[model samples]
Target: MWAKRYLSLDASRPAWAYALDAIIANHTTKSAKAARPRTKINVFLQDWNANTTTRSGLPVYARNLLNTAKKHNLSLGAIKMDKNLKRKLPLWYHLGADKHLKKLNNTTISDCLREKHGVTTIASLQRALRGEGGCDAPIYGQESVRDNCTCTTCQDLRGRGCKHPRRCRQAADRLLHFILPKWNPEDATPGDGLTLTRRRKRRNQDMLETSEGDFVFDPSVTEKGELSEAFRVFVEEDTTRHPPALRPARGRVVHQGKPPVQLKTSSTVFNALRAWKSAQEQMVSAQLAQDKSATLKKR
Candidate 1:
């Protein structure tokens, strides 16, 4: 049977001597592997008055335990602290120690996966978070590129042209005839309160106003260099004369009839207008030079 001792002391002693004596005295006739070993215990004798305290006696007791175990042919493994022991200690205590000890208790590989991939199998939820999947591809596959075919309409048909002899041009013609309208309305049911009449009217009015402006260049006048300088002057003078309408401060434009007059010169607008005028001058100068060259050649 194994023997154990618990001691309390007021002063320090030679614990190593006591430990060695205990190891020598406690012996059994049975096989070493089958027999339970007796452990030598020591309580440090603390000297309150002495300058040399029992603080250094801790490691001595540890060493004595290890030596006693070794002398008795007992297996002695290195001491291992609990994994969560560092968590109980303060942050500063474990800062310079093992990196695994410094890691947060709540942080895990599952937590990281949840953070990066937007997936959490830890809890029961219906759907995962947004942006979990990568970029989506179009449902109807459409290839971009042209192939051999001399006709303009056939050339416009994208992708490799139909290889079959009789139906090749016919297939290209059918594909070319396909008219894809740009705008698509969201709700198209009969009672869905959606009407195309109002939208069509607004679109037509915008188109008419856009076409009313005289922006087209006359080929005959351009040949004679007649309206080149005059066009430049007209653009500059018109921009200066009519500025954009100002907004009313208190109410609607109809309620106030006129906005507060604040005269300000926009640097951006001025620079743009200056650039336009410079370009116009360059064009006119080039045209005049070309005309003079032509006249000299004729003489």
Candidate 2:
């Protein structure tokens, strides 16, 4: 890769442009499982002080090299300091190079040094320019390149699934939310300051809704009575029984609804129930009359 980029023309960039990247690729990297390596401040200055020649045999100063690396998303250690670091370091004597060139919020060159450094200490985390390609189709829009496939290869599949092994959602987000510049509309912008409004799942909705490009919110789910009917049962029957599971993991809000306002719609059953109620009332009134008569006779 270095040899190929070295031979490219003016617009294609020079070989010296990839020097920091080359240095980084050849060294051991920091990981979650490993201890952090300390890259002192002298290494970059050494190269800068020594006039390293370019591919054209002209002396390319390391100062210009650091600047070029910055343009390629590499942060210079001698300039920028991380806000999270504890001990303070002198200005222009920063520890490592940050491969990810995004400026941290409220951080500057004079702040405490963040321990993000390699053995040579000029580069840290590297951020890559996200491609505007998709896994399934160029039009599907939400997914990113699959299995590190090149942008051209990923966009080839005009149907379903990914051209590569994996489909990415972040690619779609990065592409859409990035603010486009007025000067060069074709140039892709990184999504830095933009905010994405997250799609929320409505309450009592038990359906599988996707947050894809074709998102639609249907409030009719609540009005359909599928949830309300399951939650509030008026009468106890085999149909109202919940699924059995273990000792007793019942639902928290499970309860019977109010009794039916008009029970037994059949006229014969309704009439018989009313007659039985009237007969009981008449018998109670007769018993009360007999007790009153006995008390008056005694008086």
Candidate 3:
């Protein structure tokens, strides 16, 4: 009966109009799960897809209406066939009516459908429903690359050097001043608190004197020569500053039966003293040999 009435409708009517009439008729008499009038419309459309074995046989008008409802942001329920109704009407009509009624809210479905179609407005909504390619508006506008560049002047100048070189130089100078203070020559002294300027001046004077051979030293050989000089100076200074180690005696006074005296000194100091004594002995031996030769000549 529903199929006959559906077929009887004028084919000339707009697809949405026919589909809307079918939805209203099916929902008004029946207890659709969707309690609200608006909700029932969405539920009926969803059921059309669910109950039919093949959506291919659905009238073109019905298909277009379903598409329109989807564009309008309708939520659809799963369609189920009523066995009793299935025997009487075409499978399409029975299936269209019996599916589980799904709830549809206008705002939510509209937003969702809008996103799906990649459009935002209702006129575009209508065009999408009609299967027309509406205006091509990107879902999101392109992000600006220029906004994120760090060097403001460089970015503004593009390929050119900074237009405000003075300002840039001043900023750089200020930054350097903050990081490193200017050296004050007045703060320098001869003790331990020489300013960088004084130290530099002394270094320059030393270099000039060294170049003129005042110290009779080569800066290149200073490292090794300085080590040798330091050793000699340390030994001479130590010997001059400290008295020689005294030997330990067995008795307070000399006695015929007294044991031999023993001398003690640190190994390091002892070795240094031994080396100095050996050098003095070599000098005396060489002088004696020279005297012997001279005496022989006189004879």
In model 1, the runs with Cα more than 4 Å from the true position are 1-265
Q: Model 3 reaches what TM-score against the true structure?
A: 0.18
- lDDT of candidate 3 over 254-295, digit per residue (tens): 444335898868999989999999999999999999999999
- TM-score, predicted candidate 2 vs. hidden true structure: 0.18
For residue 241, give model 3's deviation from the true position in Å. Answer: 99
Clashing pairs in 3: 79-99, 80-99, 188-195
Q: In candidate 3, residue 63 scores what lDDT?
A: 53
lDDT at 127, model 3: 38
Candidate 2: which pairs clash?
96-121, 97-122, 97-123, 97-124, 98-124, 99-124, 100-125, 144-168
- lDDT, residue 161, model 2: 34
Better of 2 and 3 by lDDT: 3
Instruction: Report the number of clashing residue pairs per model.
Output: 2, 8, 3
When summed lDDT is taken over every stretch of 10 residues in candidate 3, the lowest stretch is: 180-189
Candidate 1 local lDDT, residue 145: 21
